[model samples]
Target: MSCSECGSPTIDFSLPERYRASLSTDAAVANCCTRCLTVEPVTDADTDASTPEFGRISDAVPTDQEQAIPLLLALELADSLATNRDAIESLLRDVERAGADPLLAIDRLARDPDLEPRVDLERRSHQIEQLLYYSNN
Candidate 1:
């Protein structure tokens, strides 16, 4: 998995699920170094569901972490939504400014490539979006 353009050497990685969906589907992903990014089909994603497959014969995939993403996000959003939209916008601006440093922590996990977060940020985002936009009347 070397850099395709530079041939600067590369390695296989078990990337996070958040990155899996962000690619090919979201515009925000355009900012990253796309050349090195690896996007797997949903069925082949190295998610929690992919793990226990080695122990069983069935093909059912496991669900994402139950509460990790939703709790933090809900808490944060509760705070944000409590404030005026302008205040929330300003908080987002501050977050954007603070997050410019792409987390290199992922690079450090080259050895433990299978590590996945407990909160399932990808699934949580989807749930939150549904809760916010789709009324269950």
Candidate 2:
């Protein structure tokens, strides 16, 4: 990865073992862009036992909350960084699949420093419920 500030290559960080265990599937990984210092998410399908893992990267970016912001931001980042439409769309679905509660989405949209959108929080919440129902199929 490249730095957002100077266009230099960026570094990556990983989630710790304990935190990874807290996640549902441990199928996504976090990366801090070197250029922008932004936290980026990548699906864990690309990962293997050879990949490095760690605890949370920083307190400035904690993973304890059921906040939709992380999932939303990760989706957007995935779209922007992805190579093709198919890949981007896949990431979008993942975002919708993994995001937090509608209330959390609303709260983040209302207060996030990045001004991310959460307008459809109620509808999306309902969508998630329905999706979950169908997923049981």
Candidate 3:
């Protein structure tokens, strides 16, 4: 089924029996939109519970792989830079001079459109926020 938020195709997954009982309705499955990440419970009649759908979205909708290109590029760059101890030290010094936390600097780099133009930083802002929260904890 399509997502009500972004109209992107949704991936369906079966809810465990324990969790199913908590819901008022007898929905054994839930659909999560791959793009917007919106999740909603779906009954068996709304979808085929036997086989969960995957990779059946329209061509116009960007696939997860396509959306990950910028992240991949950023990760590759970070990995390559990690091999250079001097570069890492220099980056640390720069961040220190700017009076910014190293982790926040990394988050800013990830969200910088000029650095990774293809990345939808706005859409992934929550992920960045979570990363910061977890790292602090």
Candidate 4:
């Protein structure tokens, strides 16, 4: 089955009951992909949940700063990862040294079409945010 978010073909059989309860009868067994669900996680609302949606800062119409939200999230994820730890950490220090706000930096990128993270990175960051939402709930 295809993931509701990324449209990947991977499947996740071990969806928690809360997640499963959120699905409709038509797609109880095959809904979102593993990478976009269990591995990366995704919004239940994106998969057709009747529950009220909440906590999506980017849900409002995309703005200059809103668009950069993904890159900021990706950088945060990179900061947490072992491989990109040093580079992203150094970059974070540079951001601090320059007296730059990361959100402002992202907003600048969003305003500049040519300077943004590639589409793939943006999508991954959004997906990660979705996963984070599920975890928080």
Per-model TM values vs. the true structure: 0.21, 0.28, 0.35, 0.26
- Give me the displacement of residue 79 in model 2, in angstroms: 7.2
Clashing pairs in 4: none
Q: 98-129, model 4: which lDDT tens digit per residue?
A: 45444444343334443322233443443433
Specify the highest-TM-score model's number.
Answer: 3
**Residue-wise lDDT of candidate 1 within 1-137, one digit each (tens)?**
23334333222223334433323343211111122222222332332332211111111111121221112122233323434333323323332344421112122222223423232434444343444345362
lDDT of 2 by residue, 1-137 (tens): 44343454433444434334223336445454322334444454554423332112222332433232343333333322324334333333544455534334433333444322313333444444344344443
Supply candidate 3's per-residue lDDT for 15: 52
TM-score, model 3 to reference = 0.35
**TM-score order of candidates, best first?**
3, 2, 4, 1
Q: Write the per-residue lDDT of candidate 3 for residues 1-137, one digit (tens) a residue.
A: 78777677777666545333323346777665555444467875666544544233222222332232222222222333325333334434433454544444345544543332123444444444344343443
Residue 75 accuracy (lDDT) in model 4: 48
**Sort by lDDT, top down from the best:** 3, 2, 4, 1
Query: Candidates 2 and 4: which is better by TM-score?
Result: 2
Model 3 RMSD vs true structure = 14.7
Lowest lDDT 10-residue stretch of candidate 4: 52-61
Tell me how many residue pairs clash in candidate 2.
13
Model 3 clash number: 0
